[model samples]
Target chain A: MEIRSMRFKANASAKLADAGLQRNLRKAKGKFVDTRAVAIKEIDDFEGTRRAARDLRDRVLKDLDLWLERFETQATARGATVLWARDGAEICRHVVDIARRHGVKKATKSKSMLSEEAGLNQALAAAGVEPVETDLGEYILQINDNEPPSHIIAPVMHKNVEQVADLFAKTHHKPRKTDIPQLTREAREVLRSHFLTADMGISGGNFLVAETGSVALVTNEGNGRMVTTLPKVHVVITGIEKVIPTLEDLSLLMRLLPRSATGQSISNYFSVLTGVKQPDESDGPEHLYFVLVDNGRADVVGSEYHEMLRCIRCGACMNHCPVYQSIGGHAYGWVYPGPMGSILTPLYAGIENAVDLPNAATLCGQCSAVCPVLIPLPELMRKLREEQVERKLRPLAERLALKAWAWVANRPALYALGTWFAVRYLKWLAGGGDRIRVLAAAPEWTAGRDFPAPQGKTFRELYRQRQP
Target chain B: MRVALFVTCLVDLMRPRIGFAAIELLEAAGCEVVVPEKQTCCGQPAYNSGDRASAAMLAKKTIAEFEPFDYLVAPSGSCADQIRTEYPGLLADDPEWHGRAVALASRVHELTDFLVSVAKIEKIPGAFEGSVTYHDSCAGLRSLGIKDQPRALLARMPGVELKEMTGADECCGFGGTFAVKFGDISTAIAAKKCDNVVATGADAVVAGDLGCLLNIEGKLRRMGDEKTKVLHIAEILAGDA
Candidate 1:
């Protein structure tokens, strides 16, 4: 996808003004938040599980190469081809190469963020092969001029039912269905033929178990099963960080993923695909391939951001994030969105390219509090800000202002004098009113809300007078 | 106990009464309170903005000034959190300062946390006759585990009724500089917070941090809600609200 993270401010402003997007965001936010709360409450030891998951992820990331090689050995032993890609372009090349070798015409795809990262659909189209998104959300986005998904889990979360109904009517040339079940049925019926006729299936692996060389695909809708099983070829496109040491670990993570994601104790379908179809197997893909893409993920290991690699992509962070809730994912302007996206977009896409992504968050700590794997998202963002400062990526004015504030703050007498004058000046600006209706220095703040005028005196001044 | 009150820069300038109210609460809890005049900003703006050098310089200064006190307390949870949690990490590379930072961190506490846990005050000196919905400022609620301390303190007041607001623990978007940097999004987030605050129909909306209170109050007034009171926990506990 195009990296428009540089335009975060403009994108956010446009999104905030979008009433329809705001309504969709609110509705989706309520559902995701309420369900996850109930689901988490059901767990007897959610914290302990989170800790165990973190340890497991950290252990794997520590010896990531060993785990990946083991996974390759096991997968190769089962007659599945495992390919490594250094970046998104490499990933596209591998997938397109595989498609050409297999004489594949159309590929049915389950929702995979890695593919979105690779721009795989566009690449396939350029290679003269068709890509059909089977996930209902992805399918909607695909039919709607291949619009980039605003959310990782719910691609069309920014769109309301009315908009979807209108789109379906225009695109499908069929009667519009307003209700959800009817609309879902219409989509399912439309996607059914594509699923059967597609020459290849592509999926994003939630976790690749090294012990068994199985790709664990979890989805609420049955699209994952169709995308992986119905076609002649099946290819798994995922990040190298998705590999885990054991199936036992997958069991623990599986318990958390669905609950943290959509609040289900378990997804509707959980598929563990190993290698190709066995001789006795009647219905399975004839060819199985794994494309483990290491696009900037290797640099993060052992770095300050290693914890970010532990993300299960449950998206609980974004669901609870107030900033993300206000402006839907597209404003983030990348494949990834929300708090995790704030970190990933900068790391994967150059930090200089997406400078605004890190600064955009309030460092509220909600993202860290709700993360199933316990990634310290806010802390990571703060570290990213530190990186920005070191690189001089932040605006010159901001750096100078902070430097000036720090200089004054270090001198107690100067700070006291500064505050004393500043408070009085602000109070004067209020013109005896409790609130300052206009703050010339901060037009951004005054654009929406009034700045509360400071009290007439600084606390230190009042306290000194009260003494004796 | 001799407690040094780290009057956060915001409390010092925006609403000095909160600082005075905090001193009142501390004195009522049987401590000799001293306002360290040398204290300025907690350097959160610098630290959060990624200016580590300035943050460390300020942290070192704060540690030196307040280390003499038996305990150091702050009215704002964010500043207390910066002192208690962030200072050590910020100064980790400096051996002498890191040790001092660690020592100071041990004595640091947010006002309500110190009141309920450290001071163990059984009776409240201040009284309020109205109901209030509490806003859990982000840092205090998540970083400091301050969810129950403030509520516990409020419960001690005889006539106070606590009405819980929905998503009380969510951020009010007054994330220090975040309010001004991304003011539109901050306002939208604060607008949602105001909706929850107003929905309770309580006499007032209260939080431990003045930053959040100011944002909520400012946004509430912008939304034309002039009636719902926004207050700091110190003001309510000190009978200054």
Candidate 2:
């Protein structure tokens, strides 16, 4: 979550891309962008749906407290224990306390990023219990011990099948197997045993349906179902922002989530778990606990970034983000990457700690345009930059440059003169070539690029001539 | 229609031909074009660099200069997109400035986009005998949705072959201050863009924003592939296509 050397690594990655074709990013550049293109073409009114979903979320955030209360009340009355946690430590302690009280030896988990954020596995392990991941991606990432997850949807996106096979080899104590099918089959076999023997089940809530106190999980894998049904105790860990006022409010999000995430018309499984199983039910967790972790949502409640809480965790913003496509999430140096990560990481962690988030975007507005719930990501980034400046976090040179430009810009004559002189100086520097062959300290342009001086005149000069 | 040109700082300082190209092309399509000397940079650099007060100062200056025009047009898609999409949000703090920012933002347009979408220009008077690839600037393509306007004009050029480049919509690494602050990364992206242009084997690379063109063109020079020249879309549309 705290990446000290992210900017350094990002700079290094950039250097590599300049030195070569950037083979690592290129391998998926064609693949990810192209696949998304095909997938986008398949959805009719995808843009329309995007706008509607954005509007829906805007409406939701306008009165977040009302929705959250409605959800908690409904869920608590539905035979489920609803717990509120203001921070990760609290959430971890709560979950651990439950396991300790129930004497839980092993727990099967269905890929919860919230769990990852809460550091559930480590706490559970310290309490002498094992929390085994069941979702294919999370399970893969967990066994590898590389880190938590780079992507919200694709935890192991950085890992290819080869690395996965290697991870399995070390874990299973066998020779390396490179085949994709073999790797998956081995994981499936290994997880199947855990599911059967697990005393408790843990899963992240996709949507906390307020009307029925029911939690809806949309997963491609059936692991979630097995985790919940096979265990005596089921725990649904989610953010406070995941609460929806009604099932109807949640239905709109259901349509937007899958299409935005993996481009599916509908996920394979849409499971709705309401509290615990009934008395007459043959199978299902007898005890159910819903843990709502604030993490940092409360701080942003009335702040300018409250809309960020409206995120449904679909990973749409990340998938289409240009920056994420390049460094492939690792460079974000945070659990989340891309547009959402850029905005959220700094807020979740401290801005001073994650100084790079504000600078991550190109300010292209693509993230906002594609955002299902219209979060003004670029604008938010600009605000973060302002926060940095207000805090005096940026270098004095950059701040002074802005101040000087501001003073000159407010005056027409000075701005025009400054423009004229700069252009003339450039022309003189280029000396009839139109190309500045050599550039100074501002070598960012000249380092790997060049600046073309206009042919004898600047646009302002030409316009002045036309005016005269 | 009477139109006022907001020639961006890069276009003004680095490439004046893009301005001429825009003027000639717009005039050829039958619109009265005026270049206002009172205009300055769109304040994107300061704005993006977290100087809101300065950005607001520049935004106020821009509003004062261009608010009376029928429409404010710019050759760069990135600048036009900024005026339309970002200016209002940036100035929302001051209610009076907010209205002015919104007013100025609403009427601003990218040159080719204005020429097509508003003025309804069918063809520009131009022809060039060469194959060229077009790089879709991120702000223009994604921000303003000026996808077909530039391409539509290029596709209809008389003698030019409008070949497509791979990853044409990717950033050219000229992200204002991003170029300087994050140089190593910006150059890498620029190198990728240069390769796409070279891969097309086109004589020139064309784009809506001069900023992107300059970045790509510079990389082409550093990479020692001078055969691939960089041209603004307006220049190509203004020429003998």
Candidate 3:
């Protein structure tokens, strides 16, 4: 939630040098791309499903206020409390108040990106109520003094098995265990008691079904079930954009979400809760709270970046991004990372502070291609870069160079003369070698590569000579 | 078809042979090709840098320069994609050039795409004997959907064996100004790309975009691995290598 995206380049440079992290990234690189490809290949009409999902999301976003009001009405009618928060601070205030009212000394939590975005755990801790992360990955992060989640789906993806084992060993004061099943069992054993004794449970909403007045949660781990079912009071915190018009729309997104996420046709658990448990009902929470948080999403609705609201947080963009693959997620230096982070950070955090986020991309378009909702990430990044240029946020040298180049490019004769002179200058710089190790303007271009020496003559000159 | 060649700035100044090869290939395919002298840069550096004004200025100049031809083709996919896909949007706000920009966009084509889709050449006019792997420039491969077009043309060459490299579609880190701006990250990405190209043991690496070729080739040369030569798709198709 903190605006650290200004440090993205420096963070990436540091990340690139960490061999352990690089090895982790390399090992996990192609798994997402390959699995998603296989899952997509099995579906006969995957594109049709994507289109359906996109259309439904677009429709919901078009009249988001109406949908949110409808959802609130339906949810309230179903014997659930619906509360709206204008921003992260407001959400934290409401959460802390609710926790204190419930006499909640500790709260169990499922993996929730909304909670991360709001810095809710820190807020809860400040309010004197401990928040126990129930999801294994999140639990590891929480136990490690709340280090950031690197990837959305795989929070501790930056850590290897050995690192996790070391973390668990240090936390539990037990002998180090390296085997995954044993480690998982250890985590389960440690978390089982917290799940039973926690006074409250908090989870993130995957989708808010407007028609049925239910909140949908899809997770691979059993912890979401435990977090929702064990505590007397249950709270779901999510963005305002998660509302869907119908269960049918929810079904369309379901087919795409898990497949695009971890290549599962469906996650292990899909919980659709309409309301709190009735007097006669068993094995459910006594109260439910739906907190809708609007940080900056309302401003994005009609803006040029409205399409970004369609994201379902499947993270297919991050998984397929070559830049993300190279440097890993921490380099993004935010709650979100990878391609989606590049767009969202600038918008959510001030663009002035996060200008480097958009410029970091190579305009590869891999993120958009794999995006189930088909957000044109590269084009949006370009737009953000243009905003920077218009704001004069770029280096003075670069801006002046671009302006000078554009001036010459607009005139044919000037461009011709410029190219001829530039080619000759480059040839002289090369010193008759086929490769030039350095250039006067850009020493960085020659840092790790040899620039090809320009040919002695420009093509315009050659063409003129050939003309009969 | 009478085509006007928009020899991109990099090709014109750094690699004129690519421009010559493009003209040779077009003529051999039974199309009358004219090299337009007024054409300069495609303005991608400006466009990608978020300087839309310059991008628009260059786009309008390019549109007017090649307006008379039935087709406007370029050897670089990044440049061609700029003219074909981005020009209309770049000039959208301009009352004078908006219509012309959009009209010119329809006539614009990357050289390989033009040869395969428009000219309908049965085969490349000459033979290239070597095992060459192809690197797909991000702009060309994703923007123009040009994966099969170059491969389809390359398949027609009698003696050329296409040894595919792993991660060929990955970016070569030469995102124009990005190479200088994010130099370390760019070089790191290019290092990996060149590693993949070398792993294939191909005698040469061919690509449709010269920007990517130059980046990959520069990295290879820097690493002292000059066994694998880099050539544009035009040079291979023209058999001028």
Candidate 4:
């Protein structure tokens, strides 16, 4: 995916102007936030579970090499082939080569953010193999000229039922059905045939168990199962950071993952695939392949940002963010949006160009509070901002202004004298009005609202006068 | 307890009444309150904007100024938050200031928190209002855990009828410098916040921090809502009972 993170402010303004998008996003924001809160309350020892999950993830990241080697050995022993690709291009090359080897003309895919990161569909298409999306949300986006998923868990969260109905009517050449069940039925009918016909199946693994050599696929719909099972060749594309040391760890995280994302006590389908179908087994893929992608995970692992690798891609942080709630996903202009996007976009896309991603947040801490893995999101953002300052990426005028303010703030007499004069100057700027119409150093502050005029004596002066 | 009032720079300049009200509330709660003449801004504007050096300088100055007191209380939650929660982190690497910063941070409290928790005040001797709604400033609510304290204080007022507003805990978009930097987005958020406050049809909107009150009040006035009064929680608590 292209790094459009630099255009965040402009994109946010454009998104803010779209009332329809605002309405839909606001509704989703409330629903997701409320449901997540309720879902969390229903679980016993939820915080304890979250702590255990965080510890396990941290343990896995600390020994990523050992885990990966163990996973490769175990998975290979279980008759599944594992390949490690350092970057997206390499991952794409391997996928294309595998598709051609299998004589795959068409492949059915479940929702895989890793594949999106790898641009596998475009790679496959260039290699003369078609990709069919089996997940209903992914299918809707795929049919609509391959629009990127607005959300991680819920691909078409930005789209209302009416919009989906219109798109389905246009794409399927049928009458529009605004009802959700009808829409699902129509999508299922269209996708079922593709699943049967496609030669290869591509899906993302939620968790890679190092001990068992098993990949956990968590989904609310049956399509994830179909995409992995129906095709002749099944390939799992996922980030290298998705590995866990044991199935015991996976069980604890799965407890929080579904609850945190979509607010379900448990997802409908939780499939654990150990390897390919045995010779005696009737209905499963003959070949199982794992593409463990490391676009920048290796670098982030030992760095100060190793904690970010703990993310389960739950989308809980985004679901709970106030800034993300105000501005929809497209405003972020990336594959990821909200709090996780603010952190990941800069790391993955290049921090120099993606500086605005860190600053977009108001440091509300809701994302941090809701995170199942307990990523200190605000602290990470603050550290990123500090890096930007050190790199001199901040504007010179703003930087100079901050330095000047600090200089004044460092000295009590200077701060007192400066503010005393500033108050009087601001009052004069008000021109005998209740609110200041114009001011130096800040025109935007007075754009929509007036700056409240300061009153008579500064508190220090008042306190001195009132001394008995 | 001898409390040193860190009347935040905003309350000191734009609305000294809030400072005086804070003093009155503290005095009524049986604490000896003193205003430290050397104290100025809390350096949150610098800290939040990623200028740790400036924030560190101000933190040192603040720590020195309030070092003599048994307790340091601020009228603004944000200022208190900066002093109490952030100062330790800001000066963590400083060999000279780290211990002092941590010491100051431990004794610091927001006005309502001090009144309710430390002072252990069962009732305040002042109040007057119609149906009043309270805005939970982000720092006070999230940082200081000060949601119920002000409301608990207000509950003591006989004339004041507390009406809850939607999104009371939502940020009013006065993120210190954020309002000036991203004015359009700030104004949009403030406008939405003001709309929620207005929806309650309350006679006045009150909050623990002056920054939020000013932002929400400014938006309300801009939207021709001059009649809906905006007051700091201190003012309401200090009003005649």
Candidate 5:
């Protein structure tokens, strides 16, 4: 909810030191990667599927306004109110206004990153309404002092069972459960009462099917079904980019989403709600509303970053990312985390406020390789870096250093002289050892690893001697 | 064929031996190797840092100097990738430079990739007696499709047992400027990489790029595992390890 992306370095340092969080990160890393590998391998033509998914997304994004309008018309025809929000504040205002108008006392929410982006829970609470997170991970975060979800799909992924055990004991006043099923059962039991009593249900749409005017919700838990059906009113808040042309397109994307996100053939529950409960339908909401939040997405649609809009939020990119693997999601210091977060946070939140997010990655390209929609994540981040330079958003020292290096690099003779001196100076710093443990100029580098010393002569000098 | 060796800035300054080793491998494959003295950097630092002007200037300079050679080869995958993949995109708006960049991109290759794919050398230049695990540098693996090239070359060596480490393709976090700016995070990632490398119980960990090798080796030494060797693919393939 808060933009602390400016403190990325400090937050990353703390996360790197947080032993419990590190353990959790390490434990969770293998499952996502290994399972996705297995799931993808099972597909006869996974690359073709990825291409189709990319095309599907790009097609919708190319005519995004047309798709959104079609979705609005279809949804309205099916007796659902479609509201557009320009940004987070408006999204929250729309939801809160709906709640106040309905005299809603409490609302149960499934896992919706857009809601997190809108700070929907805090807004509802401020408006004198209670918001309960029904998804297991989201519920855990809710009970734990309303801590922000560190991960997109797995909200409480930063916490280990031990931490959750302590939190559950402290908050639930129940006996601590060390085993996972018991803990999950405890959470389900706790949320069951709120699910039934809640007058309004809030959800995030995985994909809005324009063909059927459907809001598709994908989740591992049954909460998605309960949240949408067991309430008087249902409000779906999602990004405008979530729209697809047709249900057939949804089918094509569904083949990749769950497999990429959590490596499941299909999630436990996939609900497609067309409209409010008809007279014949006994178990559905009375009121249905769609709140499509543009929130900087419209600006991205036709830009160089339009490829980013194709993301289905499967989070395979982040799951495969090495930086995300090292520092968990919270270190990103935003509602979104990992490679996608690095791009989205800078674009949605001002780049000036979140400069480090773009520069934090090693440009490892693992994210790009794993993305189901095949977003060139590393390239996009590089473009963001270019934008930073264009806007003069980077620090003066870094810009100047690059400028100086470029100047020397352009002149071969000067560059040779500079490098010769650099090698000798570094060799002197190494004190004849094979490594330099303390580099005064780059303390950051020597902080954790020794610098391998130069091999005494530059390659050019060696090459020249070999020639003569 | 006369091949100009783009020795790479890191190989030029940090370890000239990799350059020599690359030259040896290329010559063994029946190619005349030339080191273009005018070359300094591939401008990855500036390009990645978003200084396109500097990156473009260096790219153009590199393109002009290396253009005359029959082929351009580099010891490092990242730099080769910068020239082969990124240069055209970086200079795309300029008609003259973009064409040059495109022409040069096809001619550039990483050392092992050239050795196996282009040179098609059948005999190995060097032999090793112990086990070695390969680290796939990110750019080489993803950008240039360089996974099998180095391994295939190493397979030709005598007594070289390739012990595959878990997540061999995973990043070691040297990411150039990223290692310095986000040192702690880079170290943390490299620490896990070291763990994987050590778990294989190989005598050496080798990679196609010096940047990743340096990071892996630096972290390995800092972790007090001095016996395990960290070598470039050129060194191991050239029997200099």
Candidate 6:
């Protein structure tokens, strides 16, 4: 039932909360930020490009079903089977059926968060197929039997190098050493062998070019290459929202995806595989299939939160978010931790179980500012809060308090009297906003900080003197 | 311009200097400033805490009280943002009140944005010498889009040594109600703010919103490090220049 992991919500004690979920985020934020700056700095018209890209995404999303249908037709025409799935169970069934038909024993995967959303690897494993992760980050988390990913671009962003090394050691049944380079080397060797021997490769598509029916994957390492090209059977599981009407629409995203993600102009490997390689194609998967997973996405369209589908998974939203920057993604208590995750997690899961997700935001609007598609993130999150209220998930106490406030607010006299009490004597009662941190009401505000005493004179009181 | 002051409930009850500073600076700018006495809290607390009924009533009350002015100004970015943004949202269900909400939004301004973009004030006309850093309050920076306005003014001030701190725009953990609801983490983040302030070796810190400043200042004082002082952007601008 826990969509995400529980983290330090509010550590009253400072020391316990200061520990880094992943050392790399702390050690590498400067590098990630700098690389992105350098990339955009090279492109003189990056902002213009971002605007064009945003407009393109807007147009595509405006008629997502149309593009998705076009993509399916185009992809199916190109000799790749495209199956539509309405929910996670359906998506998992499609993937599992593919493996069963192939008699697949080991299914190697690259980084695809949709697969995580569909819980594909576990579904495959439950069906008795060993699903191996080829991406280094995915491989690390997979071997540990741990969570899928913490951040979008960098899956295990919260794990420091030491934890990775230890995970490597435990999974490999070797002695633990907290060395990052050594651990990476170990992962590289272990996953390299799996890449060569895998029966099927299940990769996630960043964008499926509707015109060409080409599945585009942007990866840092070359594993997406191995996962898609090496296996005998290649399957891609992605949300229907990932389709673009044409390559031209994709080109706009190409400029935006890398800079916003990991701060790179382009990822190390950008591979385009069009239908199963031709008869004489040197080396590629022979059986090609794409499972297009809708899974509640259709419900999001034209709704208040339809914009959530515009995410290109840049991780910039998480990088710049104050809450994500501090506690890391895990504390958000969900798979997609930052502002983007807040909206997505609630929608994917029931809003009731994941109620805290909406409250995680400061409503800062920075996530929206940095979003390449310009998704109105904070606004969408607020809309979710509104929905949560309409659904009556909020506690009765809070509901009643708001009603009482509304009643007082409706009566000018009652509100004025309350203001009078606050302006006149609350300072004395609060002892100059002193040691009243723990009070009967507003325990949240008074915790850890004290309020300053209000002056006996309200601004109006002073203004009345001048006029009188 | 005749301006009506919306001194947020927090300032009206806890910190009056912020309200006074806004008045002094507006008066200095040659505007006729008026504080409407019947105005109560802007109802942000109840609203943000998921109490829409109370928030809606307060939003209506706020609109009725300030709709008479040519401009509605506030010293806090968060408050102004709430009035400008949330008020319209609250009154959306009521066609009559929606018009009032829209009217208030059209005239509403956070102090720094209005000061720099409208009143067009430059030169800190006051004397204060020492290194000072700024924390971009969330509402002012993200919601109100006032990032460079205050910083631009601060950089131009005479005798001020401006030192940029890392993550200057990061939230200081004073999310108004959030700070109280999530105190442990609030204090944890506030302690980081204290650390950032100490790192600058700056004599003081300045911000456009008092809510964050108070949280930062309270932690600093409670930690008993008086070397750093907190000031609202208006106080610095209204300096005895």
RMSD to true structure for each model, in Å:
1.0, 2.8, 1.3, 1.8, 1.0, 2.9
Model 4 alpha-carbon drift over 4 Å, by segment: A437-440
The residue pairs that clash in candidate 1, if any, are none
Q: What docking grade applies to model 6?
A: medium
Best by DockQ: 5
Score chain B of candidate 1 by TM-score: 0.99
Chain B alone: TM-score in each candidate? 0.99, 0.96, 0.97, 0.97, 0.99, 0.95
Question: How would you encode candidate 2's per-residue C-alpha lDDT over B52-96 as one tens digit per residue?
Answer: 888877887787888888898999888887788888987888899
Candidate 1 residue A82 C-alpha distance from true site, Å: 0.8
- Which residue ranges in model 5 land beyond 4 Å of their true spot? none
lDDT of 6 by residue, A121-235 (tens): 7788899999988888888788777565767788777677777777777788877877767777777888888888889999999998988888999998898999998998999
Candidate 1 global CA lDDT score = 0.92
> Per-prediction DockQ, in order?
0.89, 0.66, 0.80, 0.67, 0.91, 0.50
Off by over 4 Å in 3: none
lDDT accuracy of residue A284 in candidate 3: 77
Q: How do the residues B68-150 of candidate 6 rate in per-residue lDDT, one tens digit apiece? A: 99999998889899999878878899999998899779789998788787777654455678878988898778777888887
lDDT of 2: 0.79
Q: Is the docking of candidate 3 incorrect, acceptable, medium or high quality?
A: medium
Identify the leading candidate in terms of lDDT.
1
lDDT of 6 at A337: 70
Give each model's whole-structure lDDT.
Answer: 0.92, 0.79, 0.89, 0.86, 0.91, 0.77
Query: How far out, in Å, is residue B132 in model 3?
Result: 0.8
The 10-residue segment with the lowest total lDDT in model 3 chain A: A40-49
RMSD versus native structure for model 5: 1.0
**TM value for model 6:** 0.92
